[model samples]
Target: MTLKHLIGLVRALTVFVLMVGLASAANAVEKNYTVQSPDGVTIAVQEGGNPDGRPIVFIHGLLGSRLNWEEQTSSPQLQQYRLITYDLRGHGQSGKPDEVEAYRDGRRWADDLAVVLKASDAKKPVVVGWSLGGVVLSNYLAAYGDAMIGGIVYVDGVIELNAALIAPHPEVYAGLASDDLKTHLDAVRTFIALCFQTQPDPAIFERLLSNAAMASWVMTKTVPSMTVAVADSLPKTKVPVLLLYGGKDNLVMTGPSIARAQELNPSLQSKIYPDSGHAPFLEEAPRFNQDLSDFRNSIQARK
Candidate 1:
């Protein structure tokens, strides 16, 4: 290989080493807080990184919590931003309200985020959502519109959830029913395997799956409405959107979904990790982090 090629290889290795080191040190850093929603449900949240930086709120998918984005919250990328990851109403450490109304649409989720942002005194943050977290961020934009956020990053998020349009299946329900966290982790691994089309770090898969098992039971019950409501409102949103997908993602990261998302918001910027699947953030952390940083920088440049 030429010297130029060698230099590029060295840079890549340096980034990889830096990321691995950050991952190793991440587990020990943790903080917990709670935010009360409009309806009185107290949402659970976890935070890390530079508290003085620009606020970047993270929302996890169905059966996920702030822990889902643990690595991202811990990484050096966060040095430029204050990271906020939260458990939606019935998931993770958040209050699990029994009524479906409590979880319906993305309004309450957005409200919970607003409460958290207000508490943090982080104005107009860049909201990042994974899975249903994407829907929540979009709905936040829909309700409060662009006035509430600087930008949005959707990490293998549900661009829209209409089964009739996207084809839902029993695996979705089966995934939610996994009582053993290990089994849930396995299922997510299987799911990720199908989506990533490439090998992923087995340990990250395990950690996320464990979080899924702990936070997911309630998602099965509420997903139907979350899908319908978010779909109905997506097309009207005009805020800047960044969409990232795992090429191997079997759930919602398909071509049609990407196309539909773009159609809904013509300005939506998208990136695909050909080797990744549903959980791109974990499955391909380094690439995902770089892409996210680039997207954020691009937005900053525009401003």
Candidate 2:
């Protein structure tokens, strides 16, 4: 072969090898593992991004699984941070104990998180919670405190659930209580649609509905009574907190809750997406991902 042809061949082979290595790295991030909670429940977990990067743990809402954070996980900006997501007990592929006692009280929820952190070997990671996941994080703080986490992120979540604190969404809660499966599914469908400000992508919407339908109705009904108000716990939290919410959210009122959280903990910071609904992370993913990256950086800078 001519010298010029040989040089070109070498360059092409080098490029191909680089591309293969990159693809393998990306595939590595998609691996899934299982961790056993203290209560013996098996939690399904997925980890991705830079192995040496700052750890960020994601907790999904009620009836939602680790799949709920797919957008964030796939974001290029977040690729530099180690991301961990787990299917909470009673949802997704995680263990579902048929007994009401398993769902009652937030101790199991808190303990599940601890087990996931330990199993993943993540230390002082930032914990991000959405919807009911937010409540679960609050329950974690109430039970275990913030010593194990670098920061906390609340995405349209409530620290306290009381009639006097916020208006009731009878229709939303009623859907969970419905006896008929069809009636319950229909209510859940409406509730899911209301969660988005603009029409969601068809595939994502369907996947969300499918996942939501998988949750045990009995466990769903028991969660409210099981979760105690974390209002008092907020004042004691020492880690920095970032609260992200949608201005048009119809499910949980963000203004009062944000104000109350800020009142309780001055270390809290927030961003409101005016045009979005309950799921700001999914609705405005690019912006949400950037905000989260910035928050993580700020926390690291402080250290």
Candidate 3:
């Protein structure tokens, strides 16, 4: 009832409220939604982390969905930032168009990304594209330019599908495109295995396998022949670009990929994980998260 006692209680209550708010933000569950791409295909999008914090949009590779970014979405180091992820058109919970034409143009993939950004109302977020997701980034740049985005991180990205950059995997590609369920499933397993120098955790691999299985067969058959605009688009990107490659990658030739990318955009910055294979983000997640945070911080500092 005394003045000093009432002041002390108020101070304690304020501290308690602040702590609760922080906890809630840290524990916020990822929110999922579906946004229609320009062509009317529904793309499944997920958002988490501090809603008010700087945003980072994660684009997964072929046969992957938002689920591929679990290493990033659940990262404690990145909790201070907004995390956004989505499934590519024919993958995961997104609508899968049976028409081969739907997956042929690279620009449609780019437009899908734009749709996700518009739907989320993200303000110039940094985009991280992995593996096949790199194709999406190039198309996006060709279509939208860099004015709408702050920066980008290319994680073990596929710069060009040319022989010099893409490792020889005729057997795998052939099997994947096959209509035989047994052969297709076997190829999927082989392809995922080739993603890492060391094997992934059994549980994680299983989860990824399940996601890959859910992908549309039509996409697998059509996307290989899709046009890549990296040569045209990458040369024109004005935003900060970071390239992360795994030296031991079997799916993509790391050295050649980086060289081709840098040749296209001389402003690109890069890092290599000698021990990792195709998926450095998962093989070295702790390091990847810190590096990403640092990249975001550097961009913020410049602004």
C-alpha TM-score for every candidate: 0.78, 0.92, 0.93
Residue range 1-303, candidate 3, lDDT tens digits: 999999999999999999998887765677899999889899999999888889999999999888888988889889889999999999999999999988998889999999999999999899999999998998889888888899999999988768888899999999999999999999999999999898899999999899999999999999988888887788998889999999899999999899899998889998999999999899999989999999988888888
Tens-place lDDT per residue, model 1, 1-303, is 999999999999999999977864563356687878888988887766666656677888766667777668767765566677778877777887767777765677778877887776766677788877877776776666576677788887776666633435467457545676665555565654453455546786566566655653555566666633454446665656788887767667457777877877677888888877677888777777787777666666777
Clashing residue pairs in candidate 2, if any? none
Count of residue pairs whose backbone atoms collide, per candidate = 5, 0, 0
lDDT of 2 by residue, 24-105 (tens): 5864467688988887888899898877779999999877888899898888789888999999889999988888878887
Q: Indicate whether candidate 1 or candidate 3 has the larger TM-score.
A: 3
**Top of the candidates by TM-score:** 3
Worst 10 residues of 1 by lDDT: 191-200
Stretches of candidate 1 above 4 Å error? Answer: 1-31, 164-168, 171-203, 216-218, 227-236
The candidate that achieves the highest lDDT relative to the unseen native structure: 3
Q: Indicate whether candidate 2 or candidate 3 has the larger lDDT.
A: 3
Scored by lDDT, model 3 comes in at 0.91
